[model samples]
Target: MTGARAMLPLGAALALGLWLWAVRDLPWPGWPLDPQAMTLDQIRMGYGMMPRGVVALLAGAALGLAGAILQVVLRNPVADPTTLGISAGAQLALVLATVAAPDLLGPGRWPIAMAGG
Candidate 1:
Protein backbone atom coordinates (compact mmCIF):
# COMPACT_ATOMS: atom_id res chain seq x y z
CA MET A 1 0.00 0.00 0.00
CA THR A 2 0.99 3.59 -0.51
CA GLY A 3 2.56 5.33 2.52
CA ALA A 4 -0.34 7.75 3.04
CA ARG A 5 -2.93 4.96 2.78
CA ALA A 6 -0.93 2.79 5.18
CA MET A 7 -0.69 5.60 7.75
CA LEU A 8 -4.44 6.34 7.91
CA PRO A 9 -5.32 3.31 10.05
CA LEU A 10 -2.20 3.76 12.13
CA GLY A 11 -3.11 7.38 12.87
CA ALA A 12 -6.71 6.50 13.73
CA ALA A 13 -5.60 3.67 16.00
CA LEU A 14 -3.12 5.94 17.76
CA ALA A 15 -5.79 8.60 18.33
CA LEU A 16 -8.27 6.07 19.68
CA GLY A 17 -5.65 4.51 21.94
CA LEU A 18 -4.67 7.91 23.30
CA TRP A 19 -8.26 8.90 23.92
CA LEU A 20 -8.89 5.62 25.74
CA TRP A 21 -5.82 6.12 27.91
CA ALA A 22 -6.86 9.68 28.76
CA VAL A 23 -10.31 8.56 29.85
CA ARG A 24 -9.14 5.42 31.67
CA ASP A 25 -9.66 7.09 35.05
CA LEU A 26 -13.29 7.89 34.32
CA PRO A 27 -15.84 5.15 35.01
CA TRP A 28 -17.95 4.07 32.06
CA PRO A 29 -21.55 5.21 32.17
CA GLY A 30 -23.24 2.08 30.95
CA TRP A 31 -26.75 2.13 29.50
CA PRO A 32 -28.63 3.56 32.41
CA LEU A 33 -32.37 4.04 31.98
CA ASP A 34 -32.61 6.56 34.82
CA PRO A 35 -30.34 9.58 35.12
CA GLN A 36 -30.76 9.55 38.89
CA ALA A 37 -29.20 6.10 39.06
CA MET A 38 -25.92 7.39 37.65
CA THR A 39 -23.05 8.09 40.04
CA LEU A 40 -20.91 11.28 40.06
CA ASP A 41 -18.06 9.63 38.13
CA GLN A 42 -20.43 8.15 35.59
CA ILE A 43 -22.19 11.47 35.13
CA ARG A 44 -18.88 13.29 34.69
CA MET A 45 -17.73 10.71 32.14
CA GLY A 46 -20.99 10.75 30.25
CA TYR A 47 -21.70 14.47 30.24
CA GLY A 48 -18.29 16.13 30.46
CA MET A 49 -15.54 13.90 29.09
CA MET A 50 -17.53 12.32 26.23
CA PRO A 51 -18.77 15.53 24.64
CA ARG A 52 -15.39 17.23 24.99
CA GLY A 53 -13.66 14.27 23.37
CA VAL A 54 -16.15 14.26 20.48
CA VAL A 55 -15.71 18.01 19.97
CA ALA A 56 -11.92 17.70 20.05
CA LEU A 57 -11.99 14.88 17.48
CA LEU A 58 -14.34 16.82 15.22
CA ALA A 59 -12.30 20.02 15.50
CA GLY A 60 -9.10 18.14 14.67
CA ALA A 61 -10.77 16.58 11.62
CA ALA A 62 -12.03 19.98 10.49
CA LEU A 63 -8.55 21.54 10.88
CA GLY A 64 -7.03 18.70 8.85
CA LEU A 65 -9.64 19.17 6.14
CA ALA A 66 -9.06 22.92 6.08
CA GLY A 67 -5.30 22.45 5.80
CA ALA A 68 -5.74 19.96 2.97
CA ILE A 69 -8.06 22.31 1.12
CA LEU A 70 -5.76 25.27 1.61
CA GLN A 71 -2.75 23.30 0.33
CA VAL A 72 -4.64 22.09 -2.74
CA VAL A 73 -6.04 25.54 -3.57
CA LEU A 74 -2.72 27.30 -3.10
CA ARG A 75 -0.82 24.55 -4.96
CA ASN A 76 1.60 24.47 -2.04
CA PRO A 77 2.07 21.45 0.20
CA VAL A 78 2.96 23.69 3.18
CA ALA A 79 0.11 26.18 2.94
CA ASP A 80 -1.49 26.87 6.31
CA PRO A 81 -3.41 29.56 8.24
CA THR A 82 -0.15 31.20 9.25
CA THR A 83 1.15 31.15 5.66
CA LEU A 84 -1.99 33.01 4.58
CA GLY A 85 -2.14 35.22 7.71
CA ILE A 86 -5.68 34.01 8.37
CA SER A 87 -5.03 33.16 12.00
CA ALA A 88 -3.21 36.42 12.66
CA GLY A 89 -5.97 38.40 11.00
CA ALA A 90 -8.57 36.62 13.06
CA GLN A 91 -6.69 37.22 16.29
CA LEU A 92 -6.14 40.85 15.40
CA ALA A 93 -9.80 41.31 14.67
CA LEU A 94 -10.75 39.77 17.99
CA VAL A 95 -8.32 41.99 19.85
CA LEU A 96 -9.53 45.09 18.04
CA ALA A 97 -13.14 44.22 18.76
CA THR A 98 -12.35 43.61 22.40
CA VAL A 99 -10.64 46.97 22.70
CA ALA A 100 -12.84 49.11 20.42
CA ALA A 101 -16.25 47.49 20.70
CA PRO A 102 -16.57 44.91 23.45
CA ASP A 103 -20.30 44.59 22.78
CA LEU A 104 -19.65 42.96 19.43
CA LEU A 105 -17.81 40.11 21.09
CA GLY A 106 -20.51 39.64 23.72
CA PRO A 107 -22.98 38.42 21.11
CA GLY A 108 -20.71 35.91 19.35
CA ARG A 109 -16.99 35.56 18.60
CA TRP A 110 -17.38 33.41 15.47
CA PRO A 111 -18.70 36.25 13.29
CA ILE A 112 -15.76 38.49 14.08
CA ALA A 113 -13.31 35.66 13.39
CA MET A 114 -14.93 34.86 10.04
CA ALA A 115 -15.01 38.51 9.09
CA GLY A 116 -11.33 38.92 9.90
CA GLY A 117 -10.28 35.67 8.23
Candidate 2:
Protein backbone atom coordinates (compact mmCIF):
# COMPACT_ATOMS: atom_id res chain seq x y z
CA MET A 1 0.00 0.00 0.00
CA THR A 2 2.82 2.36 0.85
CA GLY A 3 4.57 1.52 -2.40
CA ALA A 4 1.38 2.10 -4.33
CA ARG A 5 0.84 5.44 -2.60
CA ALA A 6 4.42 6.44 -3.39
CA MET A 7 3.96 5.51 -7.03
CA LEU A 8 0.81 7.63 -7.40
CA PRO A 9 2.56 11.01 -7.35
CA LEU A 10 5.33 9.71 -9.58
CA GLY A 11 2.80 8.44 -12.09
CA ALA A 12 0.88 11.72 -11.97
CA ALA A 13 4.07 13.69 -12.49
CA LEU A 14 5.04 11.49 -15.43
CA ALA A 15 1.65 11.94 -17.01
CA LEU A 16 1.81 15.72 -16.54
CA GLY A 17 5.36 15.84 -17.92
CA LEU A 18 4.26 13.87 -20.97
CA TRP A 19 1.29 16.17 -21.53
CA LEU A 20 3.57 19.21 -21.37
CA TRP A 21 6.06 17.58 -23.74
CA ALA A 22 3.28 16.75 -26.19
CA VAL A 23 2.15 20.37 -26.30
CA ARG A 24 5.61 21.92 -26.26
CA ASP A 25 5.59 22.63 -29.97
CA LEU A 26 2.34 24.57 -29.87
CA PRO A 27 2.78 28.34 -29.94
CA TRP A 28 2.33 29.48 -26.33
CA PRO A 29 1.50 32.98 -25.17
CA GLY A 30 4.54 34.98 -24.20
CA TRP A 31 5.25 36.49 -20.78
CA PRO A 32 4.39 40.09 -19.88
CA LEU A 33 1.19 38.87 -21.55
CA ASP A 34 0.33 41.12 -24.45
CA PRO A 35 -2.82 39.84 -26.19
CA GLN A 36 -1.88 41.92 -29.24
CA ALA A 37 1.44 40.09 -29.51
CA MET A 38 -0.16 36.66 -29.65
CA THR A 39 -0.44 34.99 -33.05
CA LEU A 40 -3.47 32.93 -34.11
CA ASP A 41 -1.77 29.66 -33.26
CA GLN A 42 -0.78 30.98 -29.86
CA ILE A 43 -4.31 32.16 -29.24
CA ARG A 44 -5.78 28.82 -30.29
CA MET A 45 -3.31 26.85 -28.22
CA GLY A 46 -3.63 29.02 -25.14
CA TYR A 47 -7.40 29.49 -25.19
CA GLY A 48 -8.66 26.32 -26.87
CA MET A 49 -6.31 23.38 -26.46
CA MET A 50 -4.90 24.30 -23.04
CA PRO A 51 -8.29 24.84 -21.44
CA ARG A 52 -9.70 21.69 -23.03
CA GLY A 53 -6.79 19.63 -21.75
CA VAL A 54 -7.11 21.04 -18.24
CA VAL A 55 -10.84 20.44 -18.20
CA ALA A 56 -10.39 16.87 -19.38
CA LEU A 57 -7.77 16.23 -16.70
CA LEU A 58 -9.98 17.63 -13.98
CA ALA A 59 -13.06 15.76 -15.21
CA GLY A 60 -11.14 12.50 -15.29
CA ALA A 61 -9.97 13.07 -11.73
CA ALA A 62 -13.50 13.88 -10.58
CA LEU A 63 -14.90 10.73 -12.20
CA GLY A 64 -12.18 8.63 -10.63
CA LEU A 65 -12.92 10.10 -7.21
CA ALA A 66 -16.63 9.49 -7.65
CA GLY A 67 -16.01 5.90 -8.65
CA ALA A 68 -13.77 5.37 -5.65
CA ILE A 69 -16.38 6.81 -3.34
CA LEU A 70 -19.13 4.67 -4.84
CA GLN A 71 -17.04 1.54 -4.52
CA VAL A 72 -16.20 2.27 -0.91
CA VAL A 73 -19.77 3.11 0.03
CA LEU A 74 -21.25 0.11 -1.74
CA ARG A 75 -18.46 -2.29 -0.69
CA ASN A 76 -18.36 -3.45 -4.30
CA PRO A 77 -15.11 -3.37 -6.23
CA VAL A 78 -16.91 -3.18 -9.57
CA ALA A 79 -19.49 -0.57 -8.64
CA ASP A 80 -19.77 2.32 -11.10
CA PRO A 81 -22.17 5.11 -11.93
CA THR A 82 -23.38 3.31 -15.06
CA THR A 83 -23.94 0.01 -13.29
CA LEU A 84 -25.89 1.72 -10.53
CA GLY A 85 -27.94 3.82 -13.00
CA ILE A 86 -26.58 7.01 -11.48
CA SER A 87 -25.36 8.29 -14.82
CA ALA A 88 -28.61 7.45 -16.51
CA GLY A 89 -30.57 9.15 -13.76
CA ALA A 90 -28.42 12.25 -13.99
CA GLN A 91 -28.77 12.32 -17.76
CA LEU A 92 -32.51 11.92 -17.49
CA ALA A 93 -32.70 14.78 -15.00
CA LEU A 94 -30.63 17.00 -17.23
CA VAL A 95 -32.74 16.17 -20.27
CA LEU A 96 -35.97 16.75 -18.41
CA ALA A 97 -34.69 20.01 -17.02
CA THR A 98 -33.60 21.05 -20.47
CA VAL A 99 -37.11 20.44 -21.82
CA ALA A 100 -39.07 21.58 -18.80
CA ALA A 101 -37.15 24.50 -17.38
CA PRO A 102 -34.23 25.59 -19.48
CA ASP A 103 -33.48 28.40 -17.07
CA LEU A 104 -32.78 25.94 -14.24
CA LEU A 105 -30.32 24.10 -16.46
CA GLY A 106 -27.53 26.59 -15.78
CA PRO A 107 -26.52 27.18 -12.14
CA GLY A 108 -28.95 24.77 -10.50
CA ARG A 109 -28.23 21.80 -12.75
CA TRP A 110 -25.88 20.14 -10.28
CA PRO A 111 -28.48 19.92 -7.52
CA ILE A 112 -31.14 18.76 -9.95
CA ALA A 113 -28.91 16.05 -11.33
CA MET A 114 -27.80 14.98 -7.85
CA ALA A 115 -31.44 14.71 -6.78
CA GLY A 116 -32.16 12.42 -9.71
CA GLY A 117 -29.06 10.33 -9.11
Model 2 C-alpha lDDT per residue in residues 1-117, reported as the tens digit of each score = 699899999999999899888878875635336668887787777778879988998999998998899999999999998999999999999899899989986787898899789
For every candidate in turn, the CA RMSD to the true structure comes to 2.5, 3.5
lDDT of 1 at 8: 95
Model 2 per-residue lDDT at 111: 87
lDDT of residue 89 for candidate 1: 94
Could you tell me the lDDT of residue 65 within candidate 1? 95
Candidate 2 lDDT score at position 52 = 94
Tell me the TM-score of each prediction against the true structure: 0.81, 0.67
Model 1 worst lDDT window (10 residues):
26-35
- lDDT for model 1: 0.87
Write candidate 1's Cα lDDT for 8-83 as tens digits: 9998899889977887776573647566988877877778878997899799899999899999998999889998
Clashing pairs in 2: none
In model 1, pairs of residues that clash are: none
Candidate no. 2 TM-score: 0.67
- Per-candidate local distance difference test: 0.87, 0.86
